[model samples]
Target: MRENRLWSFLYKLQDKQQKWLWLRSCYFGLKTTGPLLLLGILLQGLTLSFFQPHGFFYVIYRLDRQVWVPQANFIIHSLSCIVFGMTLLLLCTAVAWYRARLFSKKETIPSMVIALFLLFLFNFHTKRMPSARLGQVILNGNIPFIEVLFLGLVSAYFYHGLNKFLHFKSLWSIAGATVSLGIVLRGFKHLFNVGFFASLSGPLFAEISSLLGDDQTQLGTIIVREVGRNLLVWLGFVSPEQILVAHTDSDLSRANLSAALIKNNLEGLPHPLNIYSLSDSFAVLGGYGQIMALLLLFILFSRYRKRRRNAWQNFLPVFLNLNSSFLVGVPVFFNVILLIPFLIVPTVSILLAAGAIKLNLIPPAVYQVPLNTPTILNAFMGTNGNWDALLFTLIVLLVSMLLYYPFFKVTETTLYRIQKGTE
Candidate 1:
C-alpha cells in the first residue's frame, strides 16, 4: 500500500512538471516578436549614435555646413518622412476600405486611421509658420482652444492604437502604453519643428534649441547624462552624500571634511574609478560568486533527486533567493516558534554592520558603486583606492551567510517531518 501511494505521488509530480513546461513553451513562442523588436531598437540606437546630425534646422537646412556632415540627421529625417507618408497612405486606404465595406473583420486598421487623423490635426495647428509675424503669433501663446482639444483627441487616439497593436489586455499594459505614448509625442514635439500638424514654433521647441546651444555634442551630452544617471539609480546605491547621511552619524564637521576630500579626489581623477581596476575586480568577484551560488544549488538538487530526500526540497527557496518558499510550502508560515530567528538573524547582521560603521568601529564606505561588480570590488572602486572596503564587504557576506544557516536548518527539519508524515 505504501509503495502504491509513493508511485501515485511521483506520477502527480511528473504531470505538474509537464504542465509547467507546456505553458512556458507557449509563452516563449508568443514572445518571439520581442527579440526582433529589440534588435530593431538596438540598430536604431546605434545609427543615431554614429550618424545622426546635430543641432536645430538640421532637417530644414540640410545644405548648411556642420561639424559632422549631418549625415545621420538626413537619414533620420528621411526615415521619419517615409514613416509619416506610409502612415498617411495606410490611413487613406483604411478609410476607403471602410467606406466600401470590403472587410468587416479587423477594426484595428480603422482605429489606426482615426489615430493618424487626430495626430495630423494636432500637427496642423502647432506647425511653425514661415512668416516672422505668424511665428511671433504662436510665440505669444495665441494657440486656439480648439487646438488643445485636438491634442487631447490625439493622445486618446494614440493610446487606442498602441493598445490594439500590442494587444494590451491588462491594466498594467494599458498604463505602460499610455506613458510610453506620452513620452514619444514629447520627443517628437521637441526634436521636430512641426506643431499640431501645423508648421509653428512653440516654447518647448525654443527651450530645447537654447539649452542645446547649437553645438554638435548636444545630443551626445544628453545621452551620456541621462544614461549615466539612470544606471546609478538602478543600483540600490544613491549619491555619496545620501549614502553617508543614511549610514553614518559622524559629527557634521568630520563627515563634511571626509566627503569633501573624496569628492575632490574623484574630480581630479580622469579614470572611470580611481581605485582598483574595475574590469579585473568586478568581473572575477561577481562572476565567481554567482557561479558558486548556482553550482551549490545544482548540487543540492542533484543530491535530493538521487536520495529521494525531502530535506533536499527545502533548498528550493534558498536556491531562488526567496527563503520563504520552502517555509510556506511546508507550512512553517504560521509557526512563530521558528519564524523569529528566521527573520531576525539576517536583519540583525546587516543592521549591526551598519551601526558599527556609523560608530567608526570600521571606516565608513566612501564610494557610490554598482553592486554588479562583486560587492567588495564595487565598494573598493567606490572608495577611490581603499582596499578596506572590499574586506568589509567580504565580512558582511560571511555574517549574512552565518545568519541564514539557522533558518535553513529549521526549514529542512520542517520538510523532513512532513515527508515522514506522508510516508
Candidate 2:
C-alpha cells in the first residue's frame, strides 16, 4: 500500500503543471529545440567516431591515410555549432514570444527582438560569438547544456518582466534595457560555468587518492564517492573524468599494473577497487551511468516511435562510448523519472563488480585499455582476455536493464499520455 502511494506521488509530481513562467518556458524551450539538439548531438558523435584519434572508427578501422577526415570533422563540427546556436536562438525567441504573448500581442515582436539582440551582445561581449571565424555564433561543447537552458529561461523572464512592469515603448529604452540585462546575465553565466562543486574537483581527486592509498579504506566508501561523482555529472557541473579518471596517474594504478604484469593475473593486486578498475570497467557501460541499459530499454519498449527512433540513432554512438547524443537527444539531462535509474544502476553495478572481485570470481581490471574500447569489453581486455570478466560485464548489464525497467515503463507511460493529450 505504501509503495502504491509512493508511485502515485511520483506520477502526480510528474503530471503537475509548472506555476512559474520561467519554468514552463524552460520546458517549452527544451521541447522546441529537441530535434535540433538531437541533430547537433548526432553530428558531434559522428565527428567523435570518424575524426578523433581514439574514436571508434579511427581505432577499429586503422585508417592509414585519412586525408578527408579532418576536413569532414571541421565541417561537421561547424555544422553542429550552427545547429546548436540556432537552437539556442530559437529557444530564447520562443520563450520571449510565449511570455510576451501572454501579456499582450503588441509586446511579442519587440520582446523577441530584444531577446535576440541581448543574446547577440551576451555572445559578442563574452567572445563566444563567431566562435571560430566569419561570425558563426555557435554554442560549442564548451557551453554545457545546463547553461543553454538557463540562459534561455532567464533571458526570457528578463524580457517578460520588462514587458510586464517597465512597459518601455521607445527604441532607445528597449536597446538600453537589453544591453544592461545582457551585461548582468553574462556575468552570471560566467559564474555559473565556474560552479561551486566544479571548483572542488582538484581537491576531491586528492582526497579520493588519499582514501585509496589508505589500506583500511572500505569498498563501501569508495562506492559512495563514485556515486557522488555520478551525481555531479548528472547535474552537468563536472565531467565524468574529473572523478572516474581521478587516480589514473597515481602510484596506485601504476602499482596495480606492475603487479598484474609480474603475476600475469589480476587477482590479489594491491589495489582492487580503484575507480578505473570498477567504474570504468563495469559502471560506465556506455558513457557514465550504464546508459546502454537505458538505450536498450528505449529500443525494446518505448511507446512513441520518436523515442524508438532516437534510441536507435543513439545506439551506435553510445555503444562507442560517446553519449552526448542520448544526453540531449532524449534529453535525460533534467528529466525526473530517468534520474532515479541513472544513478542507481551505476551504484549497483559497481557494488556487484566489487563483490565479484572480492570473492575471487573475477579479478579486478588492472591494465589500461584503448580509449575507443567498447565499454562492455573494458574489463575483459584489461584482464588479459578473461572470459569470466566478459561474462561478469554482461551480468552487470543485465542487472542494470532490470533496474532500469520500472523507471523506463513510467517514462513510456508518461510519454504516451502526453502524446494523447497533445493530439
Candidate 3:
C-alpha cells in the first residue's frame, strides 16, 4: 500500500507543468540522440565480445589474430569515437534547440551553434593534442553518461536562462555569456573531480566497505551493494565496481574458483553470495535493473506501438547484456517512475538467488563465463551446465516479469499522456 502511494505521489508530482515540461524536453532530447547511443552500446559490446581479450573472434571463433587484430582495433576505436561524438553533438544541438524554442524562438540557431562550440570548448584540453579529446568519448567500459547528460542539459539550460533573464539581443553577447558559464562550470567540475570527489569518494567507499566488512559472502552485504550499484547507474553515474566487482575478478571470486578447481566439484566454495554467483548470474539479467524483464513486458503487453517497437529494437543488444539503448531511449536513467522496479527487481532477484543457493537447490555460480554470453545462461555456464541453475535463472526472470508488469503499465500510461500532450 505504501509503495503504491509513493508511486502515486511521484506521478502526481510529475504531472505539474514545470516538471512535465522538463520531462518532455528530456524525452525529446533522448529521441534526438537515442539511436546513436544505442549504436554506441551495440558496437562497444561487439568490440568487447569479438575483439577484446578472450573475445569470441579470438578465443571461441579462432580467427586469425595477426590479420584481424590490428584492423579490429582500428575499426572498434574509430567507430566508437565517431558514434559517441555524433551522439554528444546531437544531444547538445537538440537540447539547445528545444530550450531556445521554449525560451526565445528567434535565437534558436545561434543557441545551437553556441551549444556545439561549448561542447568543443569543454572537451578541449591545453596539455593534449586535439585528437586526445576523442579519447574522452572512446566508448570503453567507462562511458561518460553522467558528464554528457550534465553538460548537454546545463549548457542548454544556461543558454535559455541567460537569454530569458538578461534579454541578450546580440548573438555575440549570448556567445560571451555562454562562454563565461562554461568556463565557470568547467572550473567547478575540475575542482570537484580533482579536489572534492577525490577527497570524498575514496574514503567514503573505504568506509562503506569497512562497514560491509571483508566478508562479502554475506547475502545482506551483496544485496545492499547490488541495490546501491543500480541506484548509481539510474542516477547516470558509472556503476563503481569497487563496491562489487565481477565474481570472476574479485579476491573472493579467485578463492572460490581455486577451491572449485581443487575440489573438482561445486559443493562448498567460498563467497557464494558474491556478485558473480548472484547479481551477475541472476539479478542483472539484460544488464542493470533486469531491463530484459521490462523489455519483455513491453513486447508482450504494451499498448503503445512505439514502445513495443523500441522493445524489439533494443532486445538483441539487451539480450547480449548491452542496455544503453533502453537506458537512453526509454531513458530509465534518472527516471524516478521506473527507478522503483529498477532497484526492486534486482534486489528481489538477488535475494531469491541467494535463497536458492543457501538451500542447495543450486550450487553457487563460481565458474567464469565469457563476455556477452546470453544472460539467462550465465548461471548455467557458471555452474558447469547445471540444469537446475538454468531453471533457477528462468524462475528469477519470471519473478522479475511479475514485479515489473505493474510499473510498466504505469510508465506506459504516463508516457502516453506525455506523448499526447495531455495534462
Candidate 4:
C-alpha cells in the first residue's frame, strides 16, 4: 500500500512539472506578439485622442472644472470596455496556446497577427456603437458576447495552425511564444485607461501594508517576499515563508518607538519632518552593496580557481551553497563541517542586532527611511545625527565575518579530502 502511494505521489509531481514546462514555453514566444500588441495599444490611444476633445492632455490635467464633462466620461468608459474585452481575448488565446500540445508543433505568427488585427477591428467597431444597440445588430444573438466568442475561436485556430506551420519542436521556440504573448498583453493594457493594472495596485498595496504594518516590517517583507522568494523559487523551494520570517517583530517595535519619539517632541519637533527617508540607508546596503559584494566574491573565486583547475573541484560547489554537490560530486559536505559556521554567522549577527534593539540596549528604529540610503547614512538620518546605528551595523558585519571564517576552514578541509581521494 505504501509503495502504491509513493508511486502515485511521484506521478503527480511529474505531471505538475510537465504542465509548468508547457506554460513556460508559451511565455517565451513573443517577438511577433510584442509588436502587434504595441500597435494595438497605439491605435487605441489614437482613437481616444481623436474622439475626445480634451484628448491626451486631459489625462494628466489636475485642474477641476465645475462643469460636467459628459462627452469625456462617455468616450473613456466606452473605449475602456472595448480595450478590456480585447485584452481578455488575447490573454485567453495565450493560455490556450500554453496548454495546447500543438503549440510545440508549429509556427503560426502570420496567422496569429492577422487574427489579432481582425479582433481589434471588431472590438473597435462594436465599441463605437451605443451599448443598448449591441443586441439589435447581432449575427446570432447578443452582439458583444458573439463578437468575443468568435474572436477567441479565431485566435485559438490561428495559434494551433501556427504551431503546425512553424514546427516549434524545440524549447526555445516555446519560450519565444510565451514572451510574444506577454508583450501583446502588455500592449493592450497600454491602450486602455480602464485600469486593469490600476485595480491591482490598491489591493496589492493594502495587502502589503497589512502584512508589513510599518517601515521596518515593510523592509523585511520586501526582502523576504521579493528577494528570498525569488532565490528559493529558483532553488526549487515551494514555499518561501517556510525559510524566511514573513513578518518580523522589529517592525512593530520600530513603529512604537516612532510614536514615543513624536509624543516626547510634540512641542519642539519640525512640522514637516520626513521620517521615511532614513529607510534609504538599509535599501542601498541590501540592494546594491550586497549584490556587488556577492558578484565580486564569485568573480574573484572563479578567477582564482581558473589558475588552479583542481581548486574548482571543491570551490565551485561551496561557492554556490550546494555543498552537497561538492560532497557527492566531489564528496565534500561532511568533511567541510567548518562551512556550517559561516552559514550561521550572518544569521547570528542579524539576530543579535534585533535582540539588542528588542531589549532596549540599542534604540528601536523610529524613522521611516528610504531603501536606497547607505547603512551609515541610514543610521545617521534615522537617529537625526546619532552614530549608534552606524556602529551597530559595523559590529554586525564584523560578527558575520568571524562566523564565516570557521565555515571557510571546513570548506578547505573538505576540498583537501576530496582531492586526496581522487589521487
- Best prediction by lDDT: 3
Instruction: Extract clashing residue pairs from model 3.
Output: none
| Candidate 1: residue 96 Cα off by (Å) | 46
Question: Please, what is the TM-score per model?
Answer: 0.28, 0.82, 0.87, 0.32
Give the best candidate by TM-score.
Answer: 3
Clashes of each: 19, 0, 0, 42
Residue-by-residue lDDT tens digits, candidate 1, 334-399: 233234333343234334444544454444344433312223344465555565556765665455
lDDT of 1 at 187: 67
* Candidate 3 residue lDDT tens string, 282-319: 98888888989999998999998988898898998788
Residue-level lDDT of model 2, residues 11-126, one tens digit each, is 76666633455556656666676677667666766766667676656666875368888788889878876776777777678767776666667767876776677667666632
Clashes of 4: 42
RMSD of 1: 18.5
Checking candidate 2 for backbone clashes, the offending pairs are none
Q: lDDT of all predictions, in order shown?
A: 0.35, 0.71, 0.75, 0.38
In candidate 2, how many clashes are counted?
Answer: 0
Ranking by TM-score: 3, 2, 4, 1
What TM-score does structure 3 among the candidates reach?
A: 0.87
